[model samples]
Structure formats: C-alpha cells, structure tokens
Target: EDGSAAWLRYAPLPHDSSHSSLPSSIITLNSTRGSPVYTAQQELRRGIQGIFGKTLNNGTSSNQHGAIIVGTAQAYQKSYGEFDDAKELEEDGYFLSSESNQVLIIGQNERGALYGSFDYLSRLAQGKLGAVSYVSNPHASIRWTNEWDNMDGSIERGYAGPSIFFENGFVTDNVTRVAEYARLLASIRINGMIVNNVNANATLLSPRNINGLGRLADAMRPYGVQLGISLNFASPQTFGGLSTFDPLDPAVDAWWANITNQIYARVPDMAGYLVKANSEGQPGPLTYNRTLAEGANMFARAAKPHGGIVMFRAFVYDNHINESNWKADRANAAVEFFQDLDGKFDDNVVVQIKYGPIDFQVREPVSPLFSTLRNTSTAIELQVTQEYLGQQTHLVYLAPLWKEILEFDMKADNRSSKVKDIISGERFRRPLGGSAGVVNVGTNTTWLGSHLSMSNLYAYGLLAWDPALGAEELLQDWIRLTFGHDKKVIETVTEMSMKSWPAYENYTGNLGIQTLTDILYTHFGPNPATMDNNGWGQWTRADKFSIGMDRTVKNGTGNAGQYPSEVAKVYESIETTPDNLLLWFHHVNYTHRLKSGKTVIQHFYDSHYEGAATAQDLVEQWNSLEGRIDVERFEHVLFRQKYQAGHALVWRDSINQFYYNLSEIKDEAGRVGNHPYRIEAEKMTLDGYRSYSVNPFHTASGAKAIV
Candidate 1:
C-alpha cells in the first residue's frame, strides 16, 4: 500500500497459481556491461523470483524444461538461427515466442532486450502467457508524460502535493522515488518523459540546470525511459543573450543547434524538446510576425541532425478577451491556425493537440483540428493530473472518458474515423509524432498521491500501447496489478472505477458544462456562477428558456462545420447528436426535449441528483472491503471515497440549484430547490446523499492558470 512503489509492487505470486506449458527457465544472454539488456537480465531475474518464486538462471546455454532465452538479436541470431531480417526491430522492437522445450526473446538493441524482458514479466503477471506467441509493442511512436514540476519545489497543476523531482531550485538528490516512477513507466511501456513545465523558461537549458537534466537522464536510462525537456522558443534572447529570437536569424538557429548537441553529448539518449508557443502569453514566433510552423521548424532543423524532435504545442489562445464583434473563439484556435500550414511543418515537429479543443474540460468535443489536418504529424494530449476532476480527492477513473474520446469517429472519409485511429497514424498512415499525457506525480505516498488515481496512469499506458483495448479489460488489468488477484477486490474496484465517471458527470457538471471549478485561478471545487463570464465556449445560451453552445453552421457558431461533411451533419442537427454531448454542441430551450423525453433543464436537474445519489452507493460498496484488503490502501481509499460521496452532494445541489434558479424550473419530485439551500443538511427528499463540510475558495482571480 506504500504507493511510493506505484505498480512495481513485486509481491509474492499465488502459491496455488499455475503456469502454462511455456518457458519455465530463462537464459539471459547479457554480457554487455551496464547495458539496458543487462538491466533486463537483472529485472527478469527479480520478476521471475517474485512472480514464480524462481531465480531464473542467466546463461548462454539452451535448456530442455521450457526456457526463456533473452538477448540482443545480434548476440543470439547466430546461436538460435538467423532472424531472416533483424532490421525491422529498429525502434526498441522485441519478439517473443513459446516452444515445447524453450522460449526465445529477441531484441534489435539493448533497449529492445529490456522491453522484451518486461513484456515477458507482464504476460506472467496477467496470466496471459498460454495464449500468444507474438511480439509486443507500444503503438504510438512516442509515449510520454509531462510533469509541470518547477525547481522552486512547487508543482503547477499537481494535486498530490509539492514534487518528488525538485526542491530549493534544484533537482532532488534523492532519486529513489523518481527511479520507481521510471519502473512504473517502463512496466507500462512508456518510453519518453518531459521532466519540466511546457510553459518553460530558458533558464532550464542553462549549464547549471542542464546538468540536473543529465542526472535525471542517467537515472531513467536503466529503465528505458528517455528524458525530454521543455524548450523555450525565446531561448536565444534569454539564455544566449541575443537581441532577437527570430527563427530566420542565424544566431538563434546556431544557439539551438549548440544546445541540442550539448544535451545529446551529456545524455546520448536525450529524447529532445517540447515547445509551447504563443499560448496564454508564452512568447513565440508571433512576436516576430512568423508563423507557428516557422518557429517549430527552426528547432526541428536544429534537432534533426542530432536525432531529436520538437513537440510543438497547439494550445495557443489569446489570453486577453475582446468583447468586440471580432469574436475570437479560443476553441477554434488550433484548427484555424494549423489548418493553413498543414503540410508545411518539418517531419520532426509534431503538433501536440489537447484531447479537447479548449483545455482538458470534463467533457468536450474532440478537437476539430484532429480531423482537419490530414498531412501533419499529430499527437493527442490528455491530462492525468486531476486539476479539473476534483484533484486527487475524488476518484474519477478517466479510462471511460478516454475511451469515448479515442473511439470518436471523425469520419474523415466514408469510413468512421475514430480519434484513436487518427492519432495512432493508422487511419491515414501519416507519421504520428506520439501521444503525451500531462500526468503529475508529486510527493504523496501513492505516487498519484492517491492510491485510486493509479487507474488513470495504468489506463494511459494501455491506451497508448493499443487504443483498441476495452476500458473494461483495462480496469481489470489495473485492479489485478495493484490489489493482486482477489475476486472481491476485483468486483469492488470494478464497480467503483467503472461508474465513477458518470458519478462525477452527475455531481459536478451535468450535460457537459464542465466541472464548474473557479475558472480564474486554481481549477478546483465547484463554482457554477463564475462559468458565465469567462468568455469560454461553454456558452449555455440560456435565458429563461435554454442552455447549450449552438455550434451548427446554420443556427450556431459554425464550429460543427470544422468536421468533415459526413461527421459535421451529426452535430449540426441536435436530433442526431448523442445526449451525452448534446449540451456541448447545440443551444436548446429549457423545454428542449432530449431523446430521454425530459426537458434539457430537467435532465440536468435529474442527472445531478441521481449522480450524487450514486456516490453513496460507491461509499457503501467500498466500506464492505474495510477488512478484506490491506488497511493502509483500504483506509486511504475508504476515506477518499467517503469524502467524495459527501463532496458529490455539494456538487449536486449547487449545480441543480444554479440551473433551477436560472430557468425557474421546479424539480418534478418536489425536491429541495430553495434559496441558500443546505444541499448537504437536507437529504431527506432523496433517500441517498452524503454531504461533507468544505471551506470552499470564494473568489475568482484572473491571470492565474490552473497549471
């Protein structure tokens, strides 16, 4: 239950468990000193010891009792017979096969060898070894996570606490927790990491800081995780002391080339740069009248020769709001800006688009830019840090939400174009840069700081590996990995984790209005009133009659036109749109009857109350496991679940009351809708509700972001 260990909880395998008729012995062909392949050998030994109570003997010799042979393809190709062509395993590829007398694990490189070792262990853990004889891979070329931890010892959007990576304006000398994080990433097949904030400063690339990055790279290399940094587009001006950072300027280009080379020299496997440009006041090419592509191209050129790439962000938005007829839609920025230069970007400059168009709201239409650009290399970005999902306090398993977003068919052609296919580079076969998750793991014992939130991390990896996997299957995998093979633990967590998103959807923001967090500052807790004035796309368009953003070409903002013709018509007409995303796509009157037959306003009222009501059920179910599981994690999850059950009530009443007062609609059941409503104190109208006391933040301060 020490979440510090994350998923690396190498516990004793079940004594009654049985292995398939596959590899029982392991042959680790690792002679190269300090190589990732060697590390693989060590890990395999440890894994086999923990899972099967067998210290797998490492050797170059073949075996008869079904042996697992692991090594770089070159070392084993001659002994185990040629691999026909070993060239395809270029980017950390591995091959595994089961035989009557032995099993062979092949690798094109040491990293591949290590990856193969981990794959072997995972199959053993999942008890899926008897079924397949195939190679394992992460589908995305780049699988990474961004941490918004700063050197000042404070994490930007991190809810778990301060930070495990930094303190006192320097990287942490204690690398134990960070090392465990690398293992977790490795176990889940995450290959890259951005160790700092994307709203990055140039000081991070300075000599004092660069060495810190080098040390981090060293710590991660053993686990096959490469280190990437957030690059400042204004680095030439700030760090190199140049008067201008124009991409056309030779000095700017030269400075970046040198920095990239120096980083490569210090850490031969440095993963390259992540750039945030012209977004929310971050300086970029726009200052010099340059296109966003031009800015990203400069670094892409600099890093190309050194085997690096630049992850250019598509999160640009004008921070200052203009009330004029200009009507700048921040939600429309990524598609508007990037669509023009679709084919202009360098091969290495990936357009990292957020999952939703306007930041990581609870529910949003997939970014239209994802469908618009056919030629550019793109990656979908997701947030694992619960900034908008009640931080780590509320257990909102995001797999279901992600499955909805990833499985969305953009209909680029006659074939339904799901977001997963678009980003995975399979639908169009374009070179996909990779997928990144903004997952912050801070100083809390549960690396997410909360034990239950670990589901998000596990799900991110599985989705990154193969977007085709089901959320139900993933939920099971995470449960087994974290809580072990207990059926009750399985059933209990499955119930809670599976329904949490809807539970969250119910209590926080019904009908896709977003978790009504205080929009101006830290995006936490419920604040429904402040949502109206934010100039955000969540324009309810409600007076006394309706609430929703009208996005149709004929009657709305024409945002729906951004999708391809086949897909555009779905959202353009409210009748065809799914009820889950109805409020997000169209403006409706209070009496607007959803397919469910309830009026739009009434649907909101019903769901919020029902959603909060469900939380009590979650609490009751969790309490049943009080003495069944480890008390540490049990108590931790129990307290949080109970806490969330109460928080759900506050969410239900505030949101329900907000809408009820706005439309003057009475609850059909004669539920409590009175002014100064004690949504918590009076739960009698409904048999189910839990209200927790909270000293909620009162004001909204503009200019500060939620991180």
Candidate 2:
C-alpha cells in the first residue's frame, strides 16, 4: 500500500481466477546459492506464493511433468538436452515456454535466466496464465540507469528525497535499500546502474569508498545488477596526489589504470565508468588542450583489461555564450564536438548523447549526433527524473516522447536509420551500444517521488530492451501489475498518462521553444525571462516582435544543418519544418501563421489554456477512481494531481502574459490579460505580507507587485 513494492506488488488475483493449471514445483539445474539462477528460483517461489497463494516445492524433482525448470541453456543442456532455442538468444536473452504441464525457462546465461523468471512472473502477475512461448532478447547490450546522487546524501536534480546510496560524503554502510532497488530494476530488465552523480566527486575513488562500492555491488549482485560509477576527470590530480591529470600524460594514465584495477579488485563485475567532462565546469582533456576522444580512450584503455566500457558523455559545450550573437547555438554542440572524432574512439567507449542537442526539453529533434557518429558506438540518454517536464509532480508518460525519438529516421546514407537502430548497434554495426536513463530515484518509498511517475521508469526499461513496444501497451501492463485489474483504473490512468507529455509541453513551452523555466537555478515553474539574457545558449530570442532560434544553415546558427543531408533539408527550410518544431528551426515574427492556421502568439495563448484545462481534467478523472483503489495510494496521487493543476495555471498565465507583454499580441479568443474572475493579491488586506515589486516581473504574469 505504501508503494514500496512498486509493480512487483504481486497482489492476489480475483478469487474467481483459476490456479489449477499453474506449475506445482520449481527446479533449478544450477544449485549455486548466490548465482543468478538461484535468485531466479527464489523469485519464482516468491511470485508463485504471492500470486497464487500457494508455495510450490523447490528442488530438482525426478518427475519434471508439472514442474518449472529454470537455468542457463548450458545447464539445461547438461541436464536434459541441447536447447536449439538458445541459439536465438543474444546476451541477457531468454526463452519462456509454458506450452504444456511443464514450464521451461531457459537463458543464454545466468543473468538471462533471472530476467526470464521476472518476465514469467510479470505475465503471471498480470493474470496471463494461458500457454505461451517466446524468446526475448535485449535490443542493446548496455541498459543502465544513471543516478545523480551525491555523496553528501543530496541528489542533483532528484526531487524525491536524499540519496539512498550515500550519506555525509560516503556510500551508506547499510545497503538494504540498494538491494531492494536492484530487485525492482532486475524485474524491469535493467542490467546496470551508475550510483553516483555525473558531476562526480574525487573522494568516490578513495580506498574507503571503493570498499563501500564493493558492499553496494555485493548487495545488488544477486539481482544480476552490475555497478558502475561516475568519475571526476581530475581524479588523478585531485584525489591521487598527482601533478597532472592530462589524458596524454603517462603518469595520469598509470594513475587511472591503478585506480581501475583497485576498483575491480573489490567489485569484479563492475559495469564501467561514466564520465561527464569539459561541460558545465567539469574538468576534462579539453583543459589540457586534448581531444575528447583522447580523454575517453584513456579511461576505455584502463577499463578494457577488466572488460568494462567507458560511457563518455557527449553533453560537452561552452557554458558561456554571447547571447547577442545570432549564430551561437548550443544545439550545435554535440555534433560539433564529436563528429570529427568518429572512428577515433576505443571500441569499449560509447558516446552517450542526450536525446536532444540541448538539455532534455519537452520536445527536441532527436540529436543529430545519433546520425553523425556512425563509426562510433552511441547510446541515447534519456531523463526519467523529469528535471524539465515538471519533475514527476505532473504525470508525464515519457514513452511516447522517447518513442518518437527512437523511431525517428535520420536518413543516414538514405537508409532506414532509426535512432533505436543506431543505439542498438544494428545500423552502425558496432559491438557496444544502448541507452542510459538519468533516473535520480531518492529515498521516497514511491521510488520516484510520486506514484504515477513510476510508470515512466517502468516504460523506460521496457523500451530500452525493446523500442518497438507501444507506449500505451507498456503503460497498461504497468497499470495492471502496479494498480490492479480494475478496468476504470487502467482506462483513466492510460488517458491521463497518454495526454500528459503533450499537456506539459503545451503549458510550459510550445512550438519547440524549450521549457520556458528558470534555467539559472531550479528548473521549475515558468520564468521566460531567465531563458534569455543568459550565458546558457538555451535561448528563445524573444524581443519586441520575433521569437524562436533560427537554426537554418542559410540564416542563423546552422544547427538545422547538423542532421544528415536528407534530414537537414527538411529542417533547413521554414516551409518544410513541422509546425511543432517551427520555432526551433526558424526565428519568426509573432504574426507568423503556423500550419495549424493560428498566428504564432495566438497558438501560444490557446495552447496554454488548453494544457492547463487538461491538467484540471486529470484531477477529475482520478477523483472518479477514489473508491476503486487503496486510500493510501489514491490520496498520495490525488495530492500531486491537485498540486499539478494549480501549478499548471501558473505556467499557463506566466508564459502567455510574458509573451503578450513582449509581442503586444492579444489572444484572438480574448483570453490573454483578461482574468475577470481573478483577485489581485495586492488588493487583499495586508497582514505579515506586503505588496512588493517582483523583479523580472514577467514571472508573475506581468504583474507589478504581489503581497
């Protein structure tokens, strides 16, 4: 009821449902107590007991007639016979067969067996008990979640609470929560996690902390989750008492090699290192006048001997931009930085590019870097923490948004170059590729601060494994497993979740203007002024008449040309660009007519009102299910819904008013600046509060003062 179990709740099925056909006994061919196969057996037993209310007998039975056999394909072959089905499985892949009285769960490896058990359990928990057989293989090899949890118990961009992995500048001594988190991740088929902030601390490389990481890894090892860490690029000089941390320097390379060896000594199956360097004040090879490839390869070489990969971030950009320059765009940074370095990286290094060229905006063209890095392994970076999309307070299902990016055809060499294919190492024909989700889960029992927000996390893992899955189908499965089989619950949650991304985009930022949030600090609420007039190149270019960033090759920053020729041609022209991203590709007058037949400013006004209205509707829909679900979860979600409804209004009014005051454009519907039902805060009788002028007054709906 507290939502600690998440989708793994395994709540009892309806009394009318039949359990007679379910397998009676569980058998594990590999009896290694601490292995993934053993974990699968334990999980199967737990799931069977919870769902059917019957504890099945464990151990190899002489009669395999009515038993579930779970093990690696090698083990199964040794026990029964060679499994032809194993050939179809890739790494961490499995086949689940319940075709007869006996159920066979075979995996390519021990981890695959564990994943198979979870998949089987998910189907059972969802009440899919009819005979079925299928081989499921992961779309990519590296499926990971990057936590931005700091060692001081604070999480950067994490909204839930303090860090569960660390406290007072060290990994936490107790890893009970870490193990629980690993279980939840394993259920969703997430194989790895980076437990520290990408803006890393050098102290994490300390001997004491390395030992602590071993403990954390041990706790998660049973669940088949490998551990990774974010490294501070200057760790050699800062933490190891070295003179230089230059990538080309032999001393620095030896320092990193030694430290990597030390880490592997403690945690043998370490997934890898994640590095965010030369961006936003982080130190990198750029500091030493070396290329990004050199920096990445240095770590890649160190981790290679231990079979670990280096996830070098492609979020590098100049923090300080001259706003007055029309051609300086941050959206061009990734391709500008990494395109020339295409075949230069070590095989074990994957360039982790954000889905967008900029930060995780509500809407962005799939980073052109996905197309440019053909010779280099690439993984799309997605944010599950909702840093820019209302930070989990609003129910924004990101699957649709991610699906759009994953399925977007970049037309690389005029071929079927989908983002998913490139990241899966299929189109590019690379060895290592996948996705890394920035899921800054904190201490909240709900895992992601809110109950509905967990759906995004659920869909993220499922999509990473298989990008072709429908967003709605994934949400429905999660709804059934987490909430229950209530038809209305499934229907209503789906409606709200499906509409959430668009609704959030409407109120916060429209027509690819980026989230008009306070970019300088807390990325919350509407602060259109903060978006412009700053060094950060996430600009709107709004003035007296025009709004948007002109990224066309002929006219502006040439960002539109970053895409492959075929894709670039579409974005390069205003007429060809989709209306949804019109602003991103061109700077237009407020009077410019959209493909929707509405003037630019008028569409802004209408969409804000429409989005806020939808937020209110979400509240009403949830209220309809008050009695259908538990009071604990119902009340918890209702509180967030109510807050979202109110905040959405602030977003709507502030954005509409800010643009109205700038462009002097009135809404065609006579809604902007006309709030007949509104009461001015300054008109109220003053108590402890006094009317004060709001600096950057557009943030307060163009109001002069507030009490």
- Candidate closest to the true structure, highest lDDT: 2
Q: Write the residue-wise lDDT of candidate 1 on 1-707 in tens digits.
A: 67776665656666556565645567767666556777777777787677777766544474435677778888887676677546556566787766454666787776777777777777677555464456655577888999988877788888788877778877778777777788788777788999888878677776767788888888888888889988878889987889999998888889888888888888888887899998877899999999999999999998898788688999987766542333345667788888898989998878899998777888888999888878888898999988888888988899888888889888887787888888877777787656899998887888776898998998897688778788888888878777887789899899988889888887777666667766777777677666655654334455667777677788766778888888788878888988877877777888889899998777887888888888889889988887777889888888888888877876776677667767888887777464354433333443455433343322211111131
**Runs with alpha carbons beyond 4 Å of true place in candidate 2:** 59-61, 686-696, 701-707
Give lDDT: candidate 1, residue 284.
94
TM per candidate: 0.92, 0.98
Worst 10 residues of 1 by lDDT: 698-707
Worst 10 residues of 2 by lDDT: 698-707
Candidate 2: residue 423 lDDT (0-100): 99
Model 2 TM-score, all chains together? 0.98
